[model samples]
Structure formats: C-alpha cells, structure tokens
Target: MSTTFEEITRPDNGPLVELNNNMQEVFSQYRKMREYASYLEYELKQKDEHILKVENENSFLRDKHTTFDSNGKSVEPIIT
Candidate 1:
C-alpha cells in the first residue's frame, strides 16, 4: 500500500502533530487577546464620550447657574 501526500499531511496523522497542537494553542491565545483588546478599546471610547458629554453638560449648567436671566449678566465674580 502507498500513502498519498494528502493522507500524510492530514491533521490526524501528521508527523508534526505536537507542533501543530502548540501552534493551534498559540493561535487561540492570540485570538483571545485580540478580542480582549478590541473590547477594551470599545470600553475606553465609550468612557471618553461619556466624559466629554458630562463635561459639556456641566459647563452648560454652570453657565446657566451663574448668568442672571433678567439682564443677561453674570452674577458670579469673574476670576482673572
């Protein structure tokens, strides 16, 4: 009986089974790390947007609180 190249290269009967196994494990770990990094980037972007939104709202509120509506003048002393 003669062995074909496909049969010899098949995963189940490969000569470098151990190397293949290690490579698969390393690839899996790399994928996991990439997914984790993607999630972290999304989280950071969301946090940054949230912070900017909150800061803008805060600035609006502070301006409204300090400015008098009667004459459109600020009641608080301007700090130089």
Candidate 2:
C-alpha cells in the first residue's frame, strides 16, 4: 500500500506537523535578523571611519591656519 500526505499528516499527527512548521519559521526569521545585524555593523564601521577621517582633516586645517602674536601667544580668530 502507498502512503499519501493526507494519511501521514492526519489529525493524530497534526501537533507534530504544526510544531515542525513553527520551528522552521523561527529559524528562518533568526537567519534574516542575523544578516541584518551584520549589515548594520558594517555600516556603523564605515561611518566611524569616515568620522575619523573628517576629524583628522579638520585638525590638520586648524593647525595649518593657526596664528601667533609677537608676544608668543596664540591669537584667536575674530568672528565679527
């Protein structure tokens, strides 16, 4: 005799089938979340590197344009 899907997944086996389906869904969702987390981590790292680069450029520009007075004192730029 050949066994059909309906016969194998009858009411008697309904709970086991449901449990397997639920587990598969949970695992699928977990994998997706892990992938998203990895992408977010990569984006954060890139942003941090860009921020550092900008800060270093700003520091270099500030040092390059710094002015000193005859009294050996640093002079602040007038914002007027």
Candidate 3:
C-alpha cells in the first residue's frame, strides 16, 4: 500500500535523463568552437592573400627603382 506501482516496478530513469542532457550541452559547446575555428581560418586566409599582394607590389616597385651595372651587379637605388 505504501509503495507506488512506479517505484516498485519501473527502473529509475532520472540518471539517464541527466546523462542525455549533459551530452546535449557538450555537443552545443562543440558546435560553437567549430564555428569559431572556421571564422579564424577565414581570417587567416585573407591575411595571407593580403601579404602576397603586398609582396608582389614591393617586388615590382623594387625592380622599377633599382639600377643594374654592366658587370651584372646592382647599384645604389635612386628613389625619386
């Protein structure tokens, strides 16, 4: 009379519910980290592209500014 039907026969499912909730929280945090990592990857690629463009421009300017001697040696650059 004192024991309920659920308490006597049904196994306790509270722990299972708690475990499932914890798994959901972990997956949510994992997704956020993955998104942040992808954003950082995009930023890094943009930075690399900017660096390549700058280097190419610098090379072009250097070739335009410098003078070569007849002995295949570089002379002092005369920057206008």
Better of 1 and 3 by TM-score: 3
Model 2 scores what on Cα lDDT? 0.91
Runs with alpha carbons beyond 4 Å of true place in candidate 3? 1-8, 78-80
Per residue, candidate 2 scores C-alpha lDDT tens digits across 34-71 of 99999999999999999999999999998777888999
Q: How displaced is residue 3 in candidate 1, in Å?
A: 23
Q: Each candidate's lDDT (Cα)?
A: 0.87, 0.91, 0.94
lDDT string for model 3 (11-73, tens) is 899999999999999999999999999999999999999999999999999888888999978
List model 1 lDDT by residue over 1-80, tens digit each. Answer: 99666545535756588889999999999999999999999999999999999999999989866856578766885789
Angstrom error at residue 24, model 1 = 0.2
Q: Rank the candidates by TM-score, best first.
A: 3, 2, 1
**Candidate 2: count of backbone clashes, pairs at least 3 residues apart or interchain:** 0
Location of the lowest summed lDDT over 10 successive residues in candidate 1:
6-15
Question: What TM-score, computed on C-alpha atoms, does each candidate reach?
Answer: 0.67, 0.71, 0.79
The CA lDDT at 36 in model 2 is 100
RMSD of each: 7.5, 7.5, 4.8
